[model samples]
Target: MCGIVGLISADGPERLASRVAAMNAAIVHRGPDDAGVHLAPGVGLAMRRLSIIDLSTGHQPMTTADGVALVFNGEIYNYRSLRAELETRGYAFRTQSDTEVILNLYHAEGMAAFARLHGMFAIAIHDQRRDELILVRDQIGIKPLYIARHEGELLFASEIKAILATLPCRPAIDPQGLWDYLSLRFMAPDRTIWAGIGKLGPGQILRRKLCSGDQSIETFWQADLTPGPFDIGRDYAREFADQFVAAVDSHIVAADVPVGAFLSGGLDSGAIVAAASELGHRAFHTFSISGDGAGGDDELPLARAVARRFGTTHHEIRMARSDYFDTLDDVVRAFDEPYGDATGAALYLLSQRASDHVKVALSGEGSDELLLGYTRAADLATLAKVERRYGPMPRPLLKLAARFVSPDRASIFRAMAEGGPGAYRRGMAAHIGWTISDAEKAAFWRGPDMVPSFDLVQGWYGLPDTAHPLAQSQQADFGTWLVEDLLMKADKMAMAASLETRVPFLHLPLVEWCQNTPMEARIGPPGQFRTKAVLRDYVATRLPDAVLNAPKRGFPLPIFPWFAERLRDAGGYVPISREFHNWISLEGLKPIVARACRNERRALEQLWGIAMFDRWCAVYAD
Candidate 1:
């Protein structure tokens, strides 16, 4: 709900304060309501407040009676309960803000207090008593925290742009980070497009000791998927219904200002609206977006269906192709890094529309990750089985058959033939298959050391030292893609519009609980047909079967076709300019561009990637 920045140095206070002030100013959009700066001998803390709670008295850079100051950037939804507990222990609070509760909680319980709270946050706590600084990101990383160290000083911010403002030198682009972006569309945690700036991984707490110049960072929570067999007879449907309702109810009450939901007409968003309606908040505000062109338009009709069902105030925004083209520069700049998700366009527009009516909106983000909602999961599982069965087949015959099959069929067969957890791991890497030829890949890729998506997958599999393959993949996502990519996108885009996006499904306890539930209970009968079975059962208990059984429609956007038609006419495709040629081979991209113009879908994906890279270079490489 805010932007937090700070500078810690062994140098003079005035110099650091000036730099910190500049960094805070860069992110004023994140917290236009209020701004505060505190400068001490070796530390400076700056905060921009959105005034979500305790608006009148919640001015921050808040300190305890003992002089430990805290600058926080998100909501601790359970702050009231933590406050009550702290009050019993003789910790007197001067304000009702969650920021005060967090300060006191750290004072009373030390680092262990983190486990007792539930919410999304990125906090910078300066303990003057110990001459130490602690930075903690939320369990699921709904908030972003970036850190950089140069010349015996540490700079941290809620956005990379803030840190960029403080540093005198140009940002260093890491080749590995760029490679990751090209291969997967986004950079991974512990790595940013900038070489020196790093993201604090989710569920991680980092402590920097001033005297020794020492830092220690570690994960405090992880998903544990060791569920026993499913028992449908135990009234699980009813229990899930009750828990779902309670979870939605609690999240709805967390905001201090007028709140609404991102009603996308999908079951996830629809179910949330339906639940909120049943809770007696009759007048709910909802928002949705539709693409401008014929093929790019989405399921706004379905969104309307849910809105009408609940009788809520629904607002719709129609985005023309020209609108997307116009905003491309701002969107890339807003991200401050190369992001490949085409949905970024839709999300940015949606958040902008939502901001007009409400200060905060609930989104259905984490449900798919927690519940194995994507078809890729089932495909990978099936492919693993096939690989095991065909291990002894002749390689030449396998290759011949692969050549004859369609790309989708070949990919599944190849994945299955590869077999084992490692193979399955590689299969799930985002953007694993090449839409471009090997020649094009070689030409387009400028980095000497390219990391295969498999390596990232393998690295994730080894993160927790656990035996659960499914859980390992999920945990890897929790650490890498979920936080670094999806959540990062959500925070940046939403904050860019000065809107607070709250995801009830991403609640820490709820995510942890879902992780422990059996996969069989979550992913139903074969073929990805009955996925999110557990969630469906829960919804069935609250509403009619019609609503529960509604087809799963993800936040769909027509990016592939949009890039081909709309962007094509508007000089959206980057020409073979010298700057682009420095990294990617123009000779390699030319054919791909030609094919994309010919309406080749696969070619368009590659063209879009190049176009995005070109656009990003134009923004950040100056």
Candidate 2:
């Protein structure tokens, strides 16, 4: 709903408001309607409001009479109920604002109140009573919060660019973060590309004391994927349909502003549009993206089919190869970090088009993670089983085999052959088409040898609670990729257009049910695997067979040819664009670009990730 920034400083309160003001200026695109700041002693808090809930009086930096101040971003779908409960307990609200509800809730329940909030948010509370600054990210990381430190001062913001605006100088790049971005296309949740700056992970809370300058971070909630018993005879498809409809309705009705949705021809978005129509919210806006030359994969016609079925206003943003190139700089600037995937650009343009008609849009993002939707789930399960049977393919053999294959197959072979603590991470990197190997890394890294990229998913991969390969893979993504990469992309891209995006599938009750249920309800037995089987079953009658039976066509853009052409025109190798470019040797990227120019699509995918990183360095490495 807004962009937030603040700091607890060692230096006295001189210019505290001005310093926080400058930080707020960096992310004005996130909140263009209203702005406010509160200063007390060594603490300063500020927010720019987009005004989704109570348009007239939802101004932020809201404070209670006892001197507790708060600035919040994102919406609380259950706030009206919470406010009614508080009113019965003798708490009189001054305005019809969720911000006031949060302020009062904190006065009543302390930190325990955060667990009761059933919505996406990044909140900062200045409780002078305890001299504490408490920061909380939502249960699924639907919102983002980044923190940085200089001297003894602590700063937090909704985006990294705001923190960078307040810094004395540019922070050094964290080598491991770069390695993770190159290998996995996103930074891990615990660290950003900058060494001293970090982000709060999903379901996490941080407490910092102003007087003593002490801090601690802890997880408040996480997905529990331990194998549990469920009745095999129960009608789970009907149960999922009912719950999903309720969740979508809850998201649609929460806003005072008009709510729209992102419609694709695929199963997830189609189901959301069907649910919204069934719930009687008709004539609402829906947005989709179309590529000029993308054949068979274009979902625009299918989106039009859904729109006609539902009687909704449909808008399609037509993009060409030139549009992809034109938006490259803006996409890098929007994320404020290195991000590689092409689908994010689609969402960015779609949200921009939707923003002209609606302030909040519902997206079906977390369904794939909740249910066993991705084909990679099956591939990973097969790899795990093969690893148990074959123990590992030897490193020298993998190295020798790499020469005979293209970069894409070489990464998969390395993943199949790798063992030890980082095996799962290596396989996941290959799953996403990262072609870099340890041998290649040694040749590319100009300084000391890079650490194993497996550390990127350590502690998140191979959780001890579940032994099922499918459950383990889902849990790993729930912890790492779901929060760190996918959710970050959704938040940044949507917020860039001053629009709020809510993921109905991530509603806590729905997520809990999917996580606790047996995997058989999602994907069937090993011999009869079906991706997102329950979801497909639920939407069987509501959608057309063409949509119901189509394979997963994820926001296809002609980016491979685009990346190949650019790299080829740049003479088949582009140098890292950072001010300090001694880390990665340009000579090592020659083979990848050469393969891409030869029309190896996977090689171009790897280069796309590298190109995004290089663009990020050019923007931020000053």
Candidate 3:
């Protein structure tokens, strides 16, 4: 993995280098081992490398013989195959790096190359001869890329902060982006934390010709949800197991570095470890984390079991309360946004320690979203069916009941009444978006009228009308939450530790095949989280029974008590930043906080989210 920055400007190459260097510097934690820059007439490309593949020889800002420059972040698991294809086409390679393959492949295929790639990547390619610069992100949006067009320049980077570093002034908060976060704890793939700077959505590309100053942005691919006949009666478990092995094998292949797995002891990561070990020649290196005194089901023991089963060398990191508090600043800084996923703190620390032992690690992210794993998917599906029948409670009634009723019920009612798009948004907000209500959202923002996050999801990429309840939920998240929240956390936290984390479940062929599979095999009953039903069946015999049956507690953090204690110590609304002080209203949540402290423990997620946003602003909003 790496930090990549590119600028399309009329400015001199010397001036552009300094700006791109600063942008690259802001995200140095992403790639601290090596740094390089390439300058064309008016375009500049820069990258900081972590040296994952071809460790001794792969220095990026890698180029073709005739001077087409490429700066890429994330891995191209299928690079070996792509390189072989190019070799047959009479292309010569100078380094054993995917960077060289991508550079040459783009030269061979141009825009068509994205379709052939099969891994997570944010690519910046500058064609000096054509005088055009293009920035592309992977089809699954597993890697993030941000773009800004200002003063006759198109600026792009792996992280938004890198783009921000080149700017003269801090960009204003995008109100829509804030609402997107308030409603979902993440911006839509199309929105960034800042107003003017836009995020390049998944499966999309931005091509800017420096000569004409004409830029074209469009999607190159999408989730192939086209309906097709699938048979569940067949031995799907074995088929899925075979596919799992293939994906894990591809993700774990490294030239000089030891590839490892983040053994969460969950169904997915554990399966990834098993597949990596069984399919590859290398022994697995596994890592896990625990809280020192904050008590809960420590996954260390379960991870140890998996490690023993796989014959992998295992390491664990334990974090105390102070460690959690101390890392909050760094956590938010790493994300470059107010990411409220509390698990990120733990993952950040785990990655920090894990990086000490290895450079690349395989994670089992993206499986739940693909396989209908999130309990919310089943719940939303039920709500969708019910909405079709009785419809939802009236809006005014739901609004009136907002305080008396749970935020979840209010959101359910809102979705039932609105139907279609609102269902997923309401369900997601109630569960993961800190359960903030519409009324609370109204009070949270003090800018232009806010857009509901669902509108963006629906507009940008909603499921087909033929998609089932489970499929609807999965596809919606596949576009929004999976990209913005889950994958964002996975990428940033791992990169923050200068570790390259690859997700086997996110492999495109696997995703496409699974998405087209029968919904019965994908999910169980509503809200039960029988996600990846077939997938689990596939790996059932491979992983320990303990891991298979253990309840799906993902990166379980005792976050509520921590936030509650902090709140009691403060005696009021905790301020995260000047913006948090100014824009986010406490009037609506005051009673909720008191009620939470008394009996309603679930309300503390919002408090925790507020504290997280505060820490982010404390670091970046300046």
TM-score: which candidate is best?
A: 2
lDDT of 3 by residue, 1-622 (tens): 7888888877776788788788889888888899999887888889999887888889988887776888998888889988999999999898999888888889998899988898888999888778788889999999888888878888888888888888888988877777667656666667777888888989998888888999889899988543345564666667677777888888777446878889876888888887877785456689988886446567777889988988888998877877888888888778888787778889998888888988888888888877767754556555566656544456566556545766555555555344443343434433334356556667555556766654454443355434444455556677777788888898889988889888889897787777677655566333444667878787778877888888778777666666666667778565756777666767755776785565355567665666666677788885
Each candidate structure's TM-score, on Cα atoms with residue i matched to residue i, is 0.90, 0.91, 0.90
Model 2 quality (TM-score)? 0.91
lDDT of 1 by residue, 386-455 (tens): 5576556765566567668875456544543444333443334433222343334776676575655445
In candidate 3, stretches whose alpha carbon ends up further than 4 angstroms from where it belongs are 225-227, 280-282, 292-296, 376-434, 457-461, 524-530
Instruction: Write one digit per residue (lDDT tens) for candidate 2, span 1-622.
Output: 9999999985567678778999999999999999999899899999989988889988888988788999999888788999999999999988888888989998999988888888899999999989999999999889999998888899999999999888889898888878766777788768899999998877899999989988999888878765456687888888888889988988988889999999999888889999999999986899989777778878888888888888889888888878877887898999999888777787888888889999999888888888868755557566566567545556567657767887655654565455432243344442332455556566666655567775445445554522555566677777677787788888999999999999999998788878877766778655667788789887889887788777787777666766677766777765557553666667777777789888697777777777777778788785
Q: Evaluate model 3: give its TM-score.
A: 0.90
State in Å the error of residue 571, model 2.
3.6
After TM-score superposition, what is the CA distance of residue 196 in candidate 1 from its true location, in Å?
1.0
